[model samples]
Target: MFNVELTSERIARERLETRRKREAERQERIFKEKVRTIGVDVKALDMQVEEKKARKGAYVLLKADAEDRRYNFEACVHQNRQKKKSREMEKALVNYRHQHQMPSTRREFDLNDPDCYRKLDPGDAQMMLPGLAGEEQDSKSRLKRQKEQLREWLLCQQKELRQGKLRKKRVIKGMMAHSSMPWTWCLVCVPARTGESPPRACNRSFSSRSTRSRRRR
Candidate 1:
């Protein structure tokens, strides 16, 4: 009877050990499944982060390029403006020099001529000073005098043409000088140069005359 009791206890202990091993295996399987699921989610999240970083880097590169292009455009425009201004200044300088330096007449002096600077003989004396020739002199003397005067006038005109500066003269206030050009030319140009209207004194005289005529009538 004792033997039978011992055998029954050993059987019961073996069944209990088997049940504990099965329970441990089931718990381990559940833990491993949960860990695998968490690893998959982490990998997907890492992919999303890397993609966002790549997009941000691309945007930064594009923005830098745009700024570079804008800077280049502004620099190009400034250079063009400076170039145009320089060209205009150069043109104006050329025009100013041309107008001042050029002679009006085609006549030129020959410095190499032997007779150009010789002492005055009778013919040269006649050319230099013709009024010295007497009134009793014949038509030849008169013609020589006229020719000398014409040469002097031409010389003055030539001097006026090159290195054109107004002659320094003492100013005489309250004095009217004669103009070489016609009065009609002066009448047209005076208003334009001096920015003045025609003489109001003449207008006043005319108005006074008109009023007097009306009273007489």
Candidate 2:
């Protein structure tokens, strides 16, 4: 009976010591600097930060991909538009050529036509003689009209020449009247026209005036 009691007491003491050691270890872990600083799971927070960064990187990649796709779509649309415009221009050119460039409508078509001689009118031969007579008459009338035009042109030129001469005479008369000079003054000044020298009296008057002006100065 004594041995049984001793064994039971020893076992109870060992269980109490193990409970205190476990409590001490739990308190040490709870109060450690790494756990006490934030009072939360550090590894869990780090994993959350990593996950956030990965999500942001993925979003950036998606945005870049979307932008590239949009650019490609717009470029494709522009290329298609250019092709359509080119096709339209070619179509318009073809239509214009078809409408205005027919072979039968060309000026040289008659030369190439095999039936040109057969298509000639029967009356064209008979009209040829009269046409020659009419052409002769037309030539005579044209010559007469040309002669009349030449006469009129000559008369107009002569009248213009006479009017020009009269204008020159009037200008000379005006100059003489404005200067209060006589025809002798004109003849003296215009030696090329009259081939004469100035008179003695005119020379004397001009010398006297020059002397008076020099004395005044």
Name the candidate that leads on TM-score. 2
Q: Write the per-residue lDDT of candidate 2 for residues 90-142, one digit (tens) a residue.
A: 99999998999877789999999887767888766343455544456577889
Q: Which one wins on lDDT?
A: 2
Q: Rate the local accuracy (lDDT) of all candidates.
A: 0.63, 0.74
Name model 2 segments beyond 4 Å from true.
5-15, 23-54, 70-100, 107-217
Candidate 1, 1-217: lDDT as tens digits: 4545588799999999999999888778767765334335777889999999999999999999999999999999999999999999999999987887554322563444456557447665644455564545477988899999999999999998652332222111101253222221222223322334445333223233454468799
Model 1 has an lDDT value of 0.63
Which sections of candidate 1 miss by over 4 Å?
1-36, 102-217
TM-score of each: 0.31, 0.36
